[model samples]
Target: MKKLMMTATALALGAGMAAADTIRMGTEGAYPPYNFINDSGEVDGFERELGDELCKRAELTCEWVTNDWDSIIPNLVSGNYDTIIAGMTINDERDEVIDFTQNYTMPDPSAYLALSKDVDVDSGVVTAQTGTIQAAFVADSGATLVEFATPEETVAAVRNGEADAVLADKSYLVPIAEEDDSLVLLDREENINMGIGMGIRESDTELREKFDAAITSMKEDGSLNELIKKWDVGATFD
Candidate 1:
């Protein structure tokens, strides 16, 4: 789940989970292997299953909601949902506006997918989803960065020859690379952020702690790593 644009600075959410017993878990519902909408029109993938388990462990009644990646944070702070179980990275920029549970997985390596093995990652046109860390990396790497609104578009840019490569999480791109003979992952990778965690509002300390405890339990019990192995979605905990 490559998430958030960081433009949502001022959030208007008041108290956290005040009126309901059910907590709304917000997700992008598009990033596959991590998250996506299944044919049944339901949220599915590693995060979906992981979120359900965490909610169960926390003894919280949770319902899922879908949001676009660009506005996920703003909507979370605006009270549209109670928590973002959306494979969001925990970082200083994001922590400024919302709290996060302990990381449930290790940092995912950002990998490059190109049309050819000979493409110069440093000098060629590269595409990335707007607001992602991969996009930020491209902006500073001397490559001409092409920003797309969706992850699908970034990959499409490479296929259409609009970009020489696309940078994204390896887990997300690995499936595509295997499915398409035209795409190949470059030899190098970029390790980004503190790893994936559930995002909650700043005021939701109680909720945060609850999920944190649940995550701790999962990590310690070794189930988290098992899930990671099952989905092949990024690195696992020790």
Candidate 2:
């Protein structure tokens, strides 16, 4: 979930330019497994590790840039960064503004989470991160869609009764549900699944091709599967 995008050109104008050789990798350092800041106060998670490897394979110098999820794309277009290695789904709405490398991770399921299993996930109030496919689905489902800026806040909204349920990526909610007896994932699953990919400016076709090749190489060599299993993020890219 995130804030809506501004014009790509306008957003790009707001950000400072990056150097030629160094690709600035932007990410939302809050989502765990997929991405998050670790004890060392650095971007330390699945994407970080995967990103570093991709850069190595592509022979591209890279630097990490932590950003809020809401403005991640706009900032990329504005020139603040070169690529978004965050767990961003490849979807039609987003593809219109920025190009994505071939998917790096397989499609992940979206599920509803609630304090109890009996809540009507289809009809009751549902919360999701703003600007996400989950939020869009909830909006169109006729359920009351409450949106928060962060995934953590969406879960909190459900716990606090501000919303009856929270809809989000199953991998994200799985550990939380396992850790807390009060939280339960509903049986219903939303059909808005999409593979996650790296976001790049549309103008950077050559850069996209380089990362694409790196991703393909990892897939062929089985290193990509290793990372997926190591992080427990989701299934491998097909």
Candidate 3:
């Protein structure tokens, strides 16, 4: 993409901008209400707004860069970007690889969908968004597993009978299922992920603290919860 090529070139040229001075915010611009590529092909969404505010509060110059979800963390570790503002879940497994600021958002509410109740919730052909625990669950559940790049595609898989069911977050699926008569939100639910946080490398303790303090400020001032409500991000700060 134009953004990707431009970012690579800037990094290669050493742009004379110290990496520590101008932070690059990386995201998987595919998940909506979280991060997504807009109609203008620019990254835009809740995470985008949140990241910008955090940068402003931290008094840091920031640039936005989008990457595939599958490679977002690895790329961050590889020094392709300075910070990950993607909606990554904070967990023991990932924390071992990279440090995380305190959670900015709560656990994502996950759900399963099917065409009808007859579609087996278990042991049936299952479709899930790729690079997720849901996909892994399906693969390990003895069901025929199908993976899709986006959450929307996973729902489509069920509609077209490509798979008997789909496992995804409720926030993304609820809007779609409510509008379509064919989509069924199954009773089954999951909360596999913990809270969401900004991913930082182990050595970037100063950078991490800045964002953490900024997040604390927002939480205390109630701005973060307001955004959570406006974006329908479910469960604001207590």
- The models' CA-based lDDT, in order, is 0.85, 0.85, 0.80
Q: Which structure is stronger by lDDT: 2 or 3?
A: 2
lDDT of 3 at 101: 96
Strongest candidate by TM-score: 1
Across 1-238, the per-residue lDDT of candidate 1 in tens digits comes to: 1111111122222366564567799999989888999999999999999999887776677899999888999999999999998768778878889888888879889999998999998998999998788888899989999999889999999999999999999989999999999899999888875688899998888678777777888887888999999999877776
Prediction-by-prediction clash tally: 0, 3, 0
TM-score of each: 0.92, 0.91, 0.86
Candidate 2: which stretches are off by over 4 Å?
A: 1-19
Tell me the RMSD of model 1 versus the true structure.
6.7
| Deviation from native of the Cα of residue 196 in model 2, angstroms | 0.6
TM-score, candidate 2, is 0.91
- Compute the lDDT for candidate 1: 0.85
Instruction: Indicate whether candidate 1 or candidate 3 has the larger TM-score.
Output: 1
Residues forming the 10-long window of minimal summed lDDT in candidate 1: 1-10
Runs of candidate 1 exceeding 4 Å displacement = 1-14
